[model samples]
Target chain A: MSSSATINRSSAFSSPRVGQRNWEYATLYIFLAPFAVLTALFGIWPIAESIRVAFTDSYTALSDSPVYVGLDNFRAVLAEPAFHSSLWRTLVYTFLSVILNVSMAIGLAILLAHPRLSRGRTFFKLAIFLPVITPDVASFIVWKWMFNQNFGVVNQALLGLGLPPFAGVTQPGSAFVTLVLVEAWHHVGLYTLIFLTNLQLLDKSLDESAQIDGADRWQRFIHVTLPQLRPAITINTVYALIEFLKTFTVIFVITKGGPNFSTNFVSYYAYSKFNSAQYGEATAIATILFVIVFAVVAASYWYMEKGDQR
Target chain B: MSDGAVTDQARRSAVRATLESTVLYTVATAIALMFVYPFYWMLVSAFRSQEAILSAPLRLIPEHLDLTAFQTIASIGGTPLSSFAFNSVVITVLATAIGVCATGLGAYALYRNPRLPLFTSVRYSFLLTIMYPHMLLVIPLYFVSYKLNLLGSTLGIILVMSLVPLIFFIFVQFFRSVPQEMIEAARIDGASEWQILTLIIVPIAKPVILTATLVAFLLNWKQWFPVMVLSTGPETYTLPVALISLNTEYGINFQATMALSTLTVVPVVIVFVLTQQRVMGSFMAGAVKG
Candidate 1:
């Protein structure tokens, strides 16, 4: 019904006369003025300004005048060993975090899809989804406390189990690992809900036929259920990849790029540069990250479109 | 003999079903508990004394009712907690209301008048903003804010955050579902396009409005990064910023920090409790339907 309305509307729009078009366009401009103005100021213009700033030595505090430094800022950012390692660390963090979080979401979605679990569905859903909605700073604060070396419940639990307490956030390696875990915990619920909704809406007849053909549950899942879940997988993977790539608050609150900059990702690196008032350098790093994210999202979207064609 | 064997196999499958269900329930419960325990601990620890919090043996239950943490948070560094709370409430409410109005009206316009070259171009620009990485824009936004003299003001924050493409996209999705007949009737009744939107369309799209409002509210309430970069001092800080600054100012006071954290979290949880079902359902419905 809606699709047909859309078609009819498009036909009407395409056939509208030129003389009357001005009046219609005028009305639309009036309606769109607010969004257009805001987007220009905050979104488009700033993006344009970022590109301009990326090539110049611009510092807000140091000087109002920006010197055209050509590719010096980009060259400096690329040459820094810190930049390379942070980029690598960010990739590793995103990779591990996406895998863990997406798998956990799928696992939980499968469990929640159980017919027998319907009675307690809302309880579990809200319990898991609560973290996704909570304020980032507040949630990070709690988790930071949870990872406290001396009094954190995690270390306490380890001690109770008769193993030595790990310096959770004080060390570089464990701190990075801890960050990945906390991030996954904070975000997995959203993907779980996404996958869960997709799962519940699945056409059950395909799986039923598979079962009737003497396929075991695992076999049916592998052959029928998994293939049908391509759309959800695409959505989850794209979203998770983008999210992990832009991770900031958890690191900001807990590690501050921590013991030897082990947990420093590109986002935090850009932020730290901004903290030092190196606007050109900061925007350069940000531009690099933006291109990376854009490429990943575009690639995934293309892959999904191809899958649909298949 | 074949019939008997079939019955035995059916019984065996039933047992297996029950076993799998039990395992599923147990795992689900454990995971929920694991996710929820830290929040539970945050609540319990807020009322605990500092020593009780730091003691070797962890106490799941509060040993005593202590108000020191709450007291400290209320009067920390001569800034009243109410001031920060008031700032957050004002910022969040204004941002949500303004954001919904802007996006809702704009989306309705786009939906009602499609394929107009100019509007289509503008619509695509908004959509482009939706996918563009915001990190790159932060530096330039700061520069823009500095030039416009909007750096330290709540209204500035509201303006910057409210015109976001996410809300616009959500509104566009919902507005697409609005039936055309209703608008045509309004038009024939001598109503203007604005009247059609305000009088006919908005009343029918209450759920979308609510969903957008809730999401914008959540996003603003939890906003800390922009506040950190844009706002200058304690006077302009929101609740989340205030809590972090308090954490920094008063280190080793976990009790007070937790108390402040709980206080910072209370309104969001209250909002969530009131509208969790509608909000979650709307989000899932929107994503799935799209």
Candidate 2:
């Protein structure tokens, strides 16, 4: 309230009344300088450099300057069977993980939002959200132990359930599933919290009105509840998509993109190339990833804006 | 079609309600356990011997607690565990402090001057970067650090990390929730813009600011890729990198790895436990409102 008054007072004091606009501009510029300078140096410049490097045959071993062998890096990346499998795997990973993660989060959020469970809300929230705050590398390493082929708790539990012990990270498909499960576990807490917040904000009167209209619990949730949580759903969907797309740490630590590159995500692929000093090829992979991520996010935002108009 | 039949239906409905409530409590408790069990396991495993950790059917309760893994960490590389922790603390604290201040001030400027060209472009650019993952920049960032001679330096990590786009967005969301009248009131009292931000705005915005700080701290604390790429040696390594090194150097020493993992997560867990309500509330409020 006071901020609006200050804004009006300042605006009124501007121009002939007081000449403060120039001062305001100067201060604004100062406030924006750190962001601008850091972003230009690290963010924008690096992005541009990656694009430029993508076209050349740049590698650390080459003494000569990078030649603009246009399309060669991209061509090479496309030709590699490794690249093909990895790209497909990454897409599948993103699609499945986002669906499972977001839906589970919503379910958990709804359960936690129940009025009957109010007494344990903090404990439940803290427990669920704990993983999201834990160090990713730490959690990944611990999960690696949990998924260990011989001594993994998961397999041990399976064996206890009268099931045969199966290789975890040593296999192809199972490795992917393990990675996805770990990823979902690490992330669902955050989305659940987001959904919980939106759930709490929902007008209960609307739910009551639906109930009065003879809608059952499931019907009320599907009809009156889900539609109202669109903003949170959109946010979570895009966030989960982006997060899954750039999932490198878990795959890097647990599998190292092994078991025939089953879990070889694009980001990890790029990092591996970079490690081997294949700078041009790595940047090309990164550029392709950048394009895909940009398109999806932009399209999602556009779709949401269109929905808002209706 | 009598009163007896109506009573029977009412009793059935009551029984159904009880059954439903029981199911809800059961499912919710199970999910919470699944979420929290791993950390509990990690803590327990950290205190177990190598034999205990690798036992076929893992024991939820160890026969005896052992700290050999912690002992290994304590004497690792002739540098104490505290040194790695000290390095992590220094890096995370400085980066978070600088990052939070820059993010808050930048968001405030953008919030106040919504239509200004400089502010608008910067604001949108941060959003654009949020869409583009940081993996794109890591390689070039390595080169950038090398060219600037910031490699293997704490200052370099702090500088690069202080520009995190998501934190910027979080701050922007928080500032948007701050009513303009707050600033207006401060200005009407002959307060400068800086004074307004410091005196009137920041105090009211403490919760979100703290949330952002916690997030910034968490990111820096858990950061691996940047440190892995930029740091040249152990001297400059943060806790995450050190933990990774512990794993690689020790060769499947699950006990030590678990112990180190526990150590790595302790500070963050402590901070989260202490301020869980305020931090989570502030975080969600920003998202919900904005």
Candidate 3:
């Protein structure tokens, strides 16, 4: 129905605009021409060029002329251990980050959405949401200091309790855990705010209908809340995935993808290679990363459609 | 459940509200402290002398306030602290202006008639922009930026930064919500597409445009990544790049680093707060829709 309407509308403009309609269309294109030109130049062209360059042996960003070497860049990228490990790690990191953020966000939204509870809701919202707006470097510095082993508060409290020392950097697993913890802390605020906004717009009668049917708190949340929250959940999860793919500054300020590259996701690895003056390989990595992200997100959407009615 | 002595139930609810308020306040205060403490620590430490910093690890307040960090910010600066603000301002102003005008135009065009060829492409292109990552073009953009001599200039940054996908993200989403029938009605009265956009779409979508501008500008303004990668000269160093440099130089000096961090962050924070109404409005629209 929507497609036909769209097509019908489009065809009307396309066919015969001999009088006033012609002038309107001309003015419309005149307004849109600059944006279209810029998008084609900066947006589409770079993307196309990047994909094309990925098949070559261009290393440095300073290269003016480079001979194309077919299939070699892809082959090299595939053979790289860092590539494989970072690929797997990106999946794990993105999955853990998205799931935890979305769930916690929903939990927070539900708690704050209770209409009768009139006490500390505003303060809680501010406390959680402030971090979302804090500049990336400053937050990174604070988290880095928090995870510091020597005079850091986390370590101090742990020691006071007679717990064993945690070497956040020297140990591999702990470092990974710390990264996860930091990422989770940093992102939870944004997602929580998103869910809260969603919950506020919701119709109150849906939950009431469930409650009258003898649904307990957990039951109300599962059947009533989750079903109504499908749209929010979809938005939250999808955006989370996009964000996790683009994450750089947090890890850059803290770990720099350190502890022997244990935390080098596809995004960071591309940055690292670019930093190393390897433009050809870096672009290849980026292309691959883009492809990976595009594929995963598409697959998820396809799968979700199969599973859910929407 | 509430029928047993309504007055008693009311009293019980009052008591619960009070208790809940206290608990919530306490919990929130603790969390806020946790979030804000490191910057606080940095501020106090910045005022203390080096020896004092080493001696008193947990000083909540400095016994002697010093201007050493501020002095350092003034004297040892190639890109003065003001320049960072200047760079951010130029980018924010130019980029915001461009984004607002362009989105208004593109959105108006699409909203004027969604079925037009250019308008149809604009719709799909805007959607594509939202999905596409900016980082995908960093390397190629570097080559282009270098070739075009856009590597270090503020104008260069403004031009490219103005090309954000988020602009379309803002506009297209907003344009969709405004009814198309309004445009048709206006057209029926012999109003030009430009006139309809200016008088009708502009006024109705004013909140959205403002929101989009605020959000888009801040996103560009806070970003230091492109500057970090493309620009090498200190003269071109953005606040974020400069902050990173400070971190590298004085990793051990908590006082100067954090003080500078706070100083650099405050303007953006202030802007964020002021424009947050618009930000929240756009977000609410997205949340309700998605």
Candidate 4:
């Protein structure tokens, strides 16, 4: 319905008018004025100013006039061991999180979409998706409390089972794993729903033919079904990657980049810098992250376009 | 082959199928539990006394329904819970309301004047902003706010949060599906553009409006980074900020924090449950189109 509507709308829009009216032009700007002004001020202007601030000696947030110091902040950030570790940790976190979230989503989508599994599909979906809609801070705080070293229910449960208590976010080694788990728990539902929607829309004849050809379920899935799900795969992967890269609130609430800074990703690192009144370095770090994210988005977009052409 | 052999094979296959389904259900249930158990614990802990919450041999259910946690947070000296709730409501309502109007009007303009070069560029520019990391924009926005004297002001946060690109795109998508003929017919009958929009477009686009409004409200309500950065004092704190401050100040007052978390999450969960279909539909639309 929407696609056909889009087609018709585009065609009608392309039809040449005799002449564009003055009032139409006037109405266009008037209608657009609020969005335009807000976007310019809050959207575009900030990005432009951020890039500009990266090169200046604006140490304080209240600096009225900052002197130009081209590349100094960038140099300092690149040279700092803390920034390097944060960047490296961020990359690792993004990689792990994307893998976990995308795989979990695909797995759950396949399970829920299975023809034999009819009962409780809605129950399973609602359960998984509830966390996605829950307020982030509230949920993370709950997770943090649950993972408390001494009194946390998680440790208590383990001890009750006559097993050694697992160190959740209290130790550096397990903190990253715990963070990824919490992040994946909070996010996987959305990606799962996306994949599930695509799965339902898929043509089932291919799978049937593959089955007739004596293909096992795994063979059918990998050779036939998985190939058809490329678009959803790309979308979920990119979205999850971007989301984990900018992960802040969870770390802020749960770990505070503590237990030896194990979860101090780039976003939190930059935020900490900003909090302590180091505007130049913070924005520079932010600028670097922005460039990296932009490159990833552009690359995936190009990949999708190329795939579409084929 | 004998008929008995065939019957035996059929019975074996049926049993195998049932076993597979059982395994599938068990795995699905466990996964679902992992996602939902924390929320359950939060609710349970909220109703338990502080001692029970911290006690060993963890109880999954509260012994009694305790109101002390709620009372404690409510009566906490300096910046009561009501103030935080008030800030959240005011910010979310103002931002979502203005955001829907601005996005609807702008999307209508873009939809109608798709041929105009300026509008085309403007549309692309709005889309382009999505590629930038929010932190990049926000880091500099802190400076922008400071310079404009909006650093600690709720109005500043509302204005910043209102200009959502995703909402704009959703509006544009929905507006494109509205029959252009209705709009044109109204225009031909001497209805002004504003009249055509409010009377013709708005009524027809109620579902989209609701979806956009709900999404905008949720986004603004859960907003933490911007509010945290902008607000200088506790007076301007939203629920999320206030909740965090409570944690930091009290230092593991389990009952109170859980109570606050419950208070924060219950309304959102209720709203989501009531409008689950619409919310899910909007997300699917956004995801597929995006």
Rank order by lDDT, top first? Answer: 4, 2, 1, 3
Q: Write the per-residue lDDT of candidate 1 for residues B108-157, one digit (tens) a residue.
A: 77888867667777776775665566654666788789878899888888
**Model 2 bad stretches (over 4 Å):** A1-19, A60-66, A203-206, A209-214, B1-17, B77-79, B185-189, B285-290
Candidate 2 lDDT at A194 equals 94
- How do these models rank on DockQ, best leading? 2, 4, 1, 3
Model 3 lDDT per residue over B1-290, tens place: 56778988899999998887676556556765765566666567667776676555566888888878777766225657888767767777787788678766876676666788656765666555445566656666676677778787776666667775655656778777788788777766656666777888779887777777777776776677777767767777767777787777767766667667777667766776666556655655554443
Residue-wise C-alpha lDDT for candidate 1, range A1-310, written one tens digit per residue? 4445435544666553442346556887788778777877888777777778888885533357767888989999999999999999999999998889888888889888889887788888988888888887988898899888765899898888999887888999999988988988899988888898789778899998888899998998889988777778788888889889988888888889988999889999998998887888988898898889889978987998898798
Candidate 2, overall lDDT? 0.81
Task: Give each model's clash number.
Answer: 0, 15, 1, 0
TM-score of chain A of each: 0.91, 0.90, 0.84, 0.91
Better of 1 and 4 by DockQ: 4
Weakest lDDT window of 10 consecutive positions for candidate 1 chain A: A15-24
Off-target runs (Cα >4 Å) in candidate 1 are A1-21, A59-64, B1-18, B185-190, B285-290
- Candidate 4 per-residue lDDT, tens place, A271-299, comes to 88887878888889999998889888889
Overall local distance difference test of candidate 4: 0.83
Top-scoring candidate (lDDT): 4
Runs off by more than 4 Å, candidate 3: A1-17, A59-64, A116-120, A160-165, A209-215, A303-310, B1-21, B42-45, B48-59, B75-77, B287-290
lDDT of 4 by residue, B134-226 (tens): 765778888888878899999998998897666876786797688888877765565556667778877888888889998888777788778
Error of 3 at B219 (Å): 1.3
Query: Clashing residue pairs, candidate 1?
Result: none
Query: How well is each residue in A1-310 modelled by candidate 3, as lDDT tens digits?
Result: 4345435545666463454567778998888876776666556666767776776676533567676888778888889987999988888888888888899788777766666445556656655665666677766776676566653656766776899877775566777788777777777776777788777777779889988989898988888778878767887888788888766777688787888887777878887887777767878888887776677678767867876874
DockQ of each: 0.48, 0.53, 0.39, 0.51
- In model 4, what are the clashing residue pairs, if there are any? none
